[model samples]
Target: MSAAAAVLREEIGGQPAVWRALVARGAQVAEVAAALDALDPPLVRIAAHGTSDHAGIYATYLLRALRGWTVVRDSMSMPLYYGSPAARPGELAVGISQSGETPDVVAWLERAGREGATTLAITNGEGSSLARIADHVLAIGAGAERSIAATKTYTGTLAAIALLAGQLAGRGPQLADALVATADAADALLDGLDAAVAPVAAALARIDRMYLVARGIELATANEVALKLTEVCYLGAKAMSATAMAHGPVAALDADVPLWAIAAPDATLPAVAEAVRRARAAGAPVIASGPAAAALDGAAFALPVPVVPAEPLLSPLLSVLPGQAFAWALAGAKGIDAGAPRHLRKVTSAA
Candidate 1:
């Protein structure tokens, strides 16, 4: 393998260890959760960008479903450009950044802190600016990520969000165990990537664009995976919730444009399956991934992921692995450096 692909693979291979470390350091999350519980915020406002924004989306669904907190994905523009506070006094404001140095995110959290909201920073950077600015911090423990594509940090952020949400919801122990199990599942998936993801990557290497569809919490997976493909493989990958796809985007599907469907065995499976049916009927190749992917009829590729048992919300922790691996493998197949994409930097600074 080229050095570029090797760098990306090494980081991806380290996710299991990152998650295990996060679980081992449960006290950090507990402290943040305790602070949150004491504040008893009426709502949550999350500030993030790019991949971190996708993690925020995952946290939005998890926090609302698990703890009944109304969560909002705050567009930093509201505060940075318009001088409006993203959070009210006594509300919870979260800033998510892999580097913990995103200018807009830092500015938003600063505004929240000034507004008397409790600020929390979820990031891999423990002593970074975002961590220092927040009232509390939960480090993802991804450990010195070198690849610009952000494989481990993304998963690490999701794991951190799960731990925090689980703690607030009073299911910390159970969720921690499930997360450790997810780490093991991720290890096994990495061990078998050649068998599972190589063929799919080879088949998709020639395609210029694709669609990723999912619903509920897994919609975050679709969006993140689409971003990965766009960044690494340089594809025009669009992501949409299944309901949104059915509305009008279904018309754009055809044989040349493939569709990747993430259908975990949860409340959204029926609608996701229906979306798969529509994609197939449109003659688009359907690549399915999730715990219940095998059950999707007529899919061109079915990548069945490990089920997290009773914790369906934790499925994204496992479901997103194949998409990550596919991006790396497809980049290799297309002779592109997965670690170094054009016109991008590790830390993006936008106002």
Candidate 2:
């Protein structure tokens, strides 16, 4: 690999090790679950910055669906930029940061902590600032990431959040086994990266802009991958729900802009299929993923992901892997620096 792409190769390929590391720390994961078990779901809020926020939202979607509790993603602008008083009386506030030190994330959790909330930090840096301020911490064990575009840390956070959400939903006993299985599946995907690169990159090789569509919880994956394509590969990618894309963006579909759809195994599959139908009708290429893959065979390219038993909660973690691979390979093909993009940093702080 060229020096420009080496970090991308190393960090993305290292995800299996990260997964195993997080699993080996099962006792620590259990501690995070125990802390969530003590709190009332209605009193819970999660604060995070950038891609970390996507991880929290993915977990929040699962927690809300499984347990029927409203968990909000606290908008950091209230405390950091607007200078408004922090919302009070939250029983728990979870902050997520790969470095555990994004200024806004730390400050929001600190204010929430002062207002009688128990703060928990989910991060890779066990001893970073957020960890010090938090009442609890769940380290991602992804080790040191060198790529400007996050690969391992994002997935590590995904697995960690799934654990906490599963525990909170009273599915605690099954979480570890589920996580292990998830990790195994992820390993298979990464291990086959050499085989995957050719097809995935070919699917994405020509596009300058495209819509990555998902519904329900999988939106988190779509949004994160869109950011990755832009930040790392200089692709003008957009992420939106299939329903939204079907209503408006579908009209813009043509051969020049394809539709990349994520159809998780849920009630939302019909909506996703509808979007795919619309795109194909408009002469746009379609590439789909998720369970019930046969339903999407009419697409120009299809990567049928098996419905893992750990799904719904673990779907985004599974679904996002293809996007990461595609973006990295496409970047390399385009001669862009997939590891280090211009004007981007591994740790962003100002906002």
lDDT of 1 by residue, 187-245 (tens): 99889975788999888779989999998899889999999999999999999998788
TM accuracy, model 1: 0.97
Q: Rate the local accuracy (lDDT) of all candidates.
A: 0.89, 0.79
Candidate 2: C-alpha RMSD after superposition: 2.1
Runs in model 1 deviating more than 4 A are: 349-351
Tell me which residue pairs clash in candidate 2.
none
| TM values, all candidates | 0.97, 0.93
Off by over 4 Å in 2: 310-312, 349-351
Cα lDDT, model 2, residue 66: 66
Q: Report the C-alpha displacement of residue 280, candidate 2, in angstroms.
A: 1.0
Give lDDT for model 2. 0.79
Residue 145 of model 1, lDDT score = 83
Residue 307, candidate 1: Cα error in Å is 0.5
Clashes of each: 0, 0
